[model samples]
Target: MTKNKIEKIFKILSKQISNPKTELTYKNPYTFLVSVVLSAQATDKSVNASTVKLFKIIKRPEEMIKLGETKLKKYIKTIGLYNSKAKNIINLSKILFEKHNGKIPSDFNLLTSLPGVGNKTASVYQNEILNIPRVAVDTHVFRVSNRIGLVKTKNPDETQIKLESIIPKKWLKSAHHLLILHGRYTCKSQKPLCGDCVVYKHCSYIKSEQNKKNISSQ
Candidate 1:
């Protein structure tokens, strides 16, 4: 896409989503990191539901480690892969407490070194906490960016690189949340609500579907 079109697409999305931010709830950086880890392959709603009580008592890495993986699993049992998530959370907490002095590291490499914190999680933590401009590619971001012709990549890592390079720097900070919210509400995986989509005019998926319909009806 042309630079002007990309700029326009973000502008429209910004207008549509007045306050684009993570839906996950947490009290501090430590809690936010844990929430992000637990959110892998899970909904924000589910993470929030689980973290409501969990975060109330566990605000630091030490607290999380003390909570133990067994108790952590009880809190997040409803979420998928809670077994592994709980283990990772406890393990990461131990690393943070023992190695990082119980503080979440600002360095991307150090953050990713923690268990359960991958590229997307590290990017998200840095972006939200450290005020870094990073476009973290989750499922929603990957799907929406590809569907709207933002980037034609097969994986999240490639999509992130392409989007960060192509998108205007001014919009990079909010792009992650904007695309996620848009995909969650309008441009869904199944039965997308094209009529309600603010950027439908710029969506390649919509245009492609229209062309297919026209061809079939001809």
Candidate 2:
């Protein structure tokens, strides 16, 4: 997209949701990291449900370690990929305690090195907790960006790079949340609510639909 188009898209999305935030519930950065880890291939509602009771007991890294892998698995088993997530969380907490003095690392490489934290999760940690201008391209961001003509890419990694390259710097921080909310509510995978979409005019998917309708009418 052109610079002017990018700016316009950012302006519209920003106006729609001024202060977008992660739906995952957490008290501190440590808990937030764990929540993001558990959120891989999982819904925020599901993560929140699991964390609600889990967080009450395991607030700090030490507490999480104390809970142990077996106990952690019990709390998170309801979530998909619970066994591995439990191990990662426990191991990551130990690293946080030993290395970072119980603080989440700010550096992306260091963050990604932790168990269960990939590029997307690291970006989320920086964006939500640290307020950094990094767009974490989750499934929602990927689908919404492609639908809205913001980025046309095959996978999440390519989508993230495309978005980082094009999206205005001012909108970087809230971009993930805005795109996520859009996909979750409007531009859904199964049935996008094109009739009510705020950016329907600029949406490539909707334009394609309109073209089909026009052709059929002819």
Candidate 3:
């Protein structure tokens, strides 16, 4: 995307949500990390439904270790991949206590090295907790960026790199939230509300015209 388009797009998004935050609810960094891990392929509402009770009992790594994998699974069973997620969360919490002195590591490599933590999850942890300027591209950011001509990439990692390079430093922190909210509310995968989209003029997706036609027909 051009510099002007990027700026304009971000400006519109920022105005819509002055302070955008992750929908996943957590009280601290450890809980936040756990929440993001559970959020993979799961809705925030589902994760929150489980974590609201999960966090109350185990807010810290030591607490999570006390909970154990078998028991943790009971709480997160509603989320997809809960069996493995529970195992990873339990093991990762143990590592946090043993290796990191019961603290969530701020370093990306260290964070990613933990069980169940990948690039996307690590970026989210660092960006939200440590105030880093990394773009953690989820499905929302990936689809919206492509549709809006921000990046012509095949995957989230490449799209994240492209966005970080092109997105102005001023908007870097909020880019993830902006793109995500836009996708969730406006530029959805099916039946994107193009007429209501703030960046409709900047979108490059040919399907948007068809969407407008479909809407008008209705």
Candidate 4:
């Protein structure tokens, strides 16, 4: 898509989504990182459900390390892959406590070096906690960007790279949350609510479907 169209789409999205932010609940950076880590294959709602009580007790890496893996499992057991998520959270907490003096690293590479933090997780942490402009391509972002023709990519990594490069700098900070909210509520994988979508006119998926319907009618 052209830059002008992309800008218009984002402008409409920005207007529609007045407050574009992460839904995951956390009190501090440590809890936010843990929330992001636990949210790998889980929904933000699920992560928040499990972390509600857990965050009250564990605010820092040292506190999380003290909680240990076995006890941590009990807290987040409702989430998918909880066993591995617990282990990684505990291990990463330990690393943070020992190496970084119990503070989440501002460096992207340092954050990615943690046990469960990958490209998406690290990008999210940087964008949210460190005030960085990063398009963390989760399932929602990947699907929405492609469907909108903002990017034509095969994988999340490629999608992230392209989105970060193409999205306007002014909108880059909130783009991640904007796209996620759009996908979660409107441009869903099954039976998308195209009629209610703010960017419906700019969506490649909608345009293609309309073309198909017109062809069929003829």
Which candidate has the highest lDDT of all?
A: 4
lDDT of 3 by residue, 1-218 (tens): 57988899899889988888788899999999999999999999999999998888888999999988889999999999999999999999999999999999888899999999999999989888999988999999999999888889999999889999999999999899888888988888888888888777778885666688899999
Q: Spell out the clash pairs found in candidate 1.
A: none
lDDT (C-alpha) at residue 124 in model 3: 89
| TM-scores, one per candidate | 0.98, 0.95, 0.94, 0.98
At residue 1, candidate 3 shows an lDDT of 59
RMSD of each: 0.8, 1.3, 3.0, 0.9
Which of the two, 1 or 4, has more lDDT? Answer: 4
Model 2 residue runs over 4 Å out of place are 215-218
Question: In order, how many clashes per candidate?
Answer: 0, 0, 0, 0
Pull out the clashing pairs in model 3: none
Worst 10 residues of 2 by lDDT: 10-19
* CA lDDT of every candidate: 0.93, 0.90, 0.90, 0.93
lDDT of 2 by residue, 1-218 (tens): 68898788778877877777889999899999999999999999999999999999988999999999999998998899999999999999999999999888899999999999999999999998888888899998998898888888999999988898888888888888989988888789899988887787777887888889999999
Query: Any idea how many clashes model 2 has?
Result: 0
How well is each residue in 100-121 modelled by candidate 1, as lDDT tens digits? 8899889899988889999999
Q: What is candidate 4's lDDT per residue for 1-218, written digit by digit as tens?
A: 88898899999999999999999999989999999999998999999999999998999988888889999999999999999999999999999999998988898889899999999999999999998999999999999999889999999999999999999999999999999999999999888899999888888998899999999999
The worst-scoring run of ten residues by lDDT in candidate 4 lies at 198-207
lDDT accuracy of residue 46 in candidate 1: 94
Clashing pairs in 2: none
